[model samples]
Target chain A: MTAQAAQADQLASSHGHLVIIGGGEDKERDMAILKRFVELCGGPSAKIVVVTAASAVCARMWETYDRAFRDLGVTRHVHLHLMTRHDANDEDLIRDVLDADGIFMTGGDQKRLLAIIGGTALDAEMHAALKLRGACIGGTSAGASAMSGHMLAQGRAELHPEKGSVSLGAGLGFLHKVVIDQHFSERQRLSRLLSVVAQNPYLQGIGIDEDTALVVERGVGIEVVGEGAVTIVDGRAMSTNVAEIADHATPELIDVRLHLLPAGSRYGLPGADDRDARRIPPPLLEFLENITKRNPIS
Target chain B: MTAQAAQADQLASSHGHLVIIGGGEDKERDMAILKRFVELCGGPSAKIVVVTAASAVCARMWETYDRAFRDLGVTRHVHLHLMTRHDANDEDLIRDVLDADGIFMTGGDQKRLLAIIGGTALDAEMHAALKLRGACIGGTSAGASAMSGHMLAQGRAELHPEKGSVSLGAGLGFLHKVVIDQHFSERQRLSRLLSVVAQNPYLQGIGIDEDTALVVERGVGIEVVGEGAVTIVDGRAMSTNVAEIADHATPELIDVRLHLLPAGSRYGLPGADDRDARRIPPPLLEFLENITKRNPIS
Candidate 1:
């Protein structure tokens, strides 16, 4: 385990689960990501709160998600959008967070999410729901980006690991030592995520491709869901010359480990009682080996 | 102390000092803030590094500070600006952080600073220099905002406390729990600051007017310097209907304590050896009392 990741807390709340969907989940097709989300909310009977605070068109976002969840058999659904900071501190809004079994954040801008709900009473309440009430909190795209403690606020889709490629902000901070990038492959965000990891070696970067999700079950492990792949960049033991490069020069990275997780594969995060050092499951290891055999980078 | 602040680290590392300057510091007249920074770095003999990563006109910023430091009689000076992530990872840049007696950040865009140098080797070096090497690290304007762990990335100078007025991001994070706002009175950022405090009750808000500075000594206390006032907004006991206000309606703030300290006033922080409960010095207290008597808001 890496130094920081070893000390970093689990992505899941133990009592709750986290579904971070890379934007563009197949809503019109298999709807696998959304279906899994609803199922994780204890299936249909869950009281789900759809937060469209991040969306520019909140009402439309709510309508679309409401319809999707309803189709997935979710009976109790509510829409809570913050038009301003005032709404973030409302008692009713906080109550909504407390009462939610599943809290879903829609895509728009991560900055909007932080501005509207970052550290307000409603923010406290949402955390309370996740930690205390065991509510499953999830989001997509900008929503997914807001889950990390050190959030990636904005950045261009640079192909090279150069400086000024990304800007980070404080997220809802659901997870630590991990930075998430949405629409990973589709948006060509690999270099962005790499830049993030290169800056903070202790951090483990996870880039989720479109139509995919990285499901974190606190203290258990992470599972990839949907059609695309989940890329994990581990830089704990890596060596890099990120400190001495020129203005436009690409950074040189060595010993950085990359893991590709497809649907149905499981990678374990060491839990409180996690023993037997090998955290990777045998099946997951076998899959990695096969993939390694198929395409050797070195 | 507020819950989060109770755990928040001191603004100054135990080994170093912190000088956060509001924007437009007087480079022409007294230059008291700059003088203090220089003095803290052990005077004219100190080797100083000025980081202009935040500025768009990097060369101009470097030239301005270079002249100021020279006027202050500092012989050795270096300029380090990360034009790209590569520069941030440069070994020479890291060495400069280690070798410098004082490191100063210039005013520009806080977001730009984060984009160029937020998490790179240079960021790590800056932190290391302060914490381990006992080098005094300081900044002005956008530089000041970046000192806080939870930085106020951008915000409008609204006269009333309202939502959607500001966006918070990840700062250099030399300090925690406390948020700093530069060009406070000049920009009329009271409502903006109030909104910040309301959203994050755990954070103490420091709004420094232009030409002024807040000097924080680790585990010791803070002192005001320069021409203008430093507005300290303590919302630990304040109550707000922020969780339930309308979109444009001003937030009703109750029980919030505001302290306005002019130059030469010393405020006490609860250090490890802070024995007495009374933190405010008797003279400072008298000043506050006199001001309160002069202007009774209630």
Candidate 2:
């Protein structure tokens, strides 16, 4: 198939927006990152559902987001409690879930959040809202980590690739083929993300820095929002000593296609057209182009 | 490179197809699942050869399937059996297996079948037929379980998800990343399926219900055919205490994604697309489009 046709086929199935934020989002002042979410949800009038299942202080998490949206002039909003697996499939919540224009998740424990809702009817509805109803789905910190189909559940914060540092789990699947890590720069989690990418290699690891968000447009490219950068670790062509490493041993990662994308930059979705390849964001195309440029035909 | 492109490239190297059926596929009436196997084999003109190595009652199994194929208008159908491991390399059988458009294996003891044919010339020919010369391979029950890279040989039938309830071994290697279990819901083998996946969350466990088939389209998505469901237990991101829990102790499985797909649903090959996640008959998609056609998203 033509590259265009192939890219089109990949995106033909995607019908939603994803707003994945790093931890320590600004709730006060401009609230620029969260406002982008509100705007994507069809402005202040859109009905939004905030899932605070990940938080230990669920009520506080709910109140915080509730007040944030209210200040943004959102008229209709509600908090979804998925404290148990049963609550994730509660019949009464189905209608509200279906009607929602925006589905936002709060930060806390991503593992705890997914444990209750994974594979539940509520999870299905959330998928439906995104895939069928064109909803803008936003998440922060732990919420951001759970957006991937294969989520990186746990890993010790490290600056070097540790063999046994990273632990993975399934996520809500807004994004596939990529694992997200929040508090990237702030937590110095470059190694945690690197560990997974080195082990799998085929999987792309994306680490979102604190106060920043990666806004994924439906079936298109991604835009960086907020103050910090989004670090992408693509190891598809990398060489590593992962296989030779002992348990908890640090491994060497070489020739990995790493990109640190700062705010105000946009990147082409993988395999899509690269009309703006030579732009501010040095993503797939630009990087590949640079390689070709470095070694000229002459 | 795009992961999809990489995956497609890997799958394309194997120019073949697999029609994996759960136990007790219907031979009488419409024989929908078997018909699908025939269709995948390039219709009635296709040469079909059945291997009854797994069955203790080989002749009876052969007769039933032979008659079923004949009724479906297949004229060039034959059965090949291996009474011993030496019989697997019988020169006469080699030509038939290598030339056959479709190679169907019967239900019985997978271990017994493997002991006779594994690594033999006939087994090599089957892989050659599947990989080198594009052929359709259909399997039922034990035939299905032996198709995975790591086959589930034996497991206790249990209703509740239990621990240490599974036994694994090598197989024909038709599918990787998944372990197959036939006679699933009919025999209440969910626990057995869960046991294996929980132990190694990386491997997905697929329990195929009776009279159903999971049609794997090479390098593409999968389509479910027949009367029952295909239960997919994905624990890739599941949080479990398997490491801390003792053997035979029921480990807690958190964040596992489960899907019970019935007839005619299409799922993305390795990565699933939830748009076709629902159970609906084949001819309903057009109706779905017509109903939703009235209103177009702006």
Candidate 3:
């Protein structure tokens, strides 16, 4: 495990559960990811606040999700469409979000969503609801991308990694240790994700495939759900020849550990107690062991 | 004073002092800023370590700083020139930095310095040295720019603020509440600084002029020194008409409080005791009162 993960583990496990879903989650079929979100939010009586700021079709998106939640038996839910910054600071709206059992953000443009809500009174209250009140926070697509403190704002997809291809921006900061990217397999965004991880080795990169979701119990564990798998890119023990690369050029990364986790599998996050029990892939183990031997702490 | 400053004031006032100097500091004439840095490091008996990773001419810069410190009567010092990531993880190098009385990072390219030292054992030790050992830390130019958690990597200087003009990157993170911009007046970076503040209103913008330095005694107060004035941009209660602006367009910010402090002036940072004594600029006072009245907490 990386030192950061260990440090995260040491933090008090009091923060709320984060249901971060990739784009195109199965809402009509089983609604498995949404179901888990509702379950975590106290089921039928869940006071869910749907944030549709990211979507261009805010009203229609809200109506669709409102019906989906109602179909899943969620009786108490509110739609919050923050078109402007003023909407974010609405005292009544802030109070509603603060009192919510679950706050879910829908998909569209992550930048637009953040531009409206980032650093506002509503943003502060959303953080408080999750950290202090243990309210379940969920997001999909652009919403999912906005979950991390350092977000993948926009980037081009490619098989080979290129420097300066992926652009990063400030997110809502619900997650601090990792960078999240959605529609992984659907868009072939491995290159962009790798570029981001290469640039920022301290941050772990999690690429969630379309229809998949990672249920993160902050400072504890992550459980994968939905139709596909989650790609865990560990750059902690990575060795990259990025210095040799020129500006806007492709970077060469060596020994970056990649873990493919399918649905139903649970993985220990930074602060998990049973970290040793989860088997490390051979390549990752070898890489980590080499790093430990080379850089032993006195 | 902003809420962040108030929170910073509440923190234990036990952290070390930070001598963050803007570019073009008067090293030859009087050497006032460097002398203050040396004094903060416990005077002549100070064990100072000079990090020249930012400079392309690392050896030359080290020798020049070495002579300056020596002329100021600092007897014990070491030079750290990290060209690669391996040098950043070097145990001996890490030990030297951690054991130093003061750690000074010279100017060059902030990205190069951060890319080499960021997320390494050396980076961790640097933080520990400042937080745990109370070791006075000093940085100039690019070094000063890299002191904040959110850094302004690259941008153009314009009279009007553009949305996508300024590019940001992760810094060494010694300072968390504000974003530092160096050579402020010389480069005409007010537009970019305002743009950044508009995008991320949670962070206050600090523009340090050439030959000026902001001496931050963490968790206590900030004292400006040298020839020019330091421009303080508070965006906490700012109202921006950014939603109306298109992509890569200029943003209009209203109610952003700007404070100009010349050398010898002191301002209470977060956790400061005599906050009330430091007169709030009339406009800022009116803005704060309006916010308090509008957003009254129950």
Q: Against the unseen true structure, what C-alpha lDDT does each candidate score? A: 0.73, 0.75, 0.74
- lDDT by residue for model 1 (B171-282), tens: 8888777788998866667668877887787887888878888887655566778877676666776655567765654454544555556555565543434354236643
| TM-scores, all models, native as reference | 0.45, 0.45, 0.45
Q: Flag regions of model 3 displaced more than 4 Å.
A: A1-298, B1-14, B269-298
Interface RMSD of each: 26.3, 21.4, 24.3
- Candidate 1 docking category? incorrect
Alpha carbon lDDT at A59, candidate 1: 92
Summed backbone clashes in each candidate are 14, 2, 8
- Candidate 1, residue B169: lDDT: 90
Which pairs clash inside model 2?
A169-B237, A170-B237
**Per-residue lDDT of candidate 2, residues B104-127 (tens digit):** 999999998888887788878887
- Which tens-of-lDDT digit does each residue in A219-298 have in candidate 2? 45667788877767677766556797688765544345555565656655455454773233323553322211211111
Residue-by-residue lDDT tens digits, candidate 3, A250-292 = 4544345555555666645433465643443333343223211
TM-score of chain B of 1: 0.85
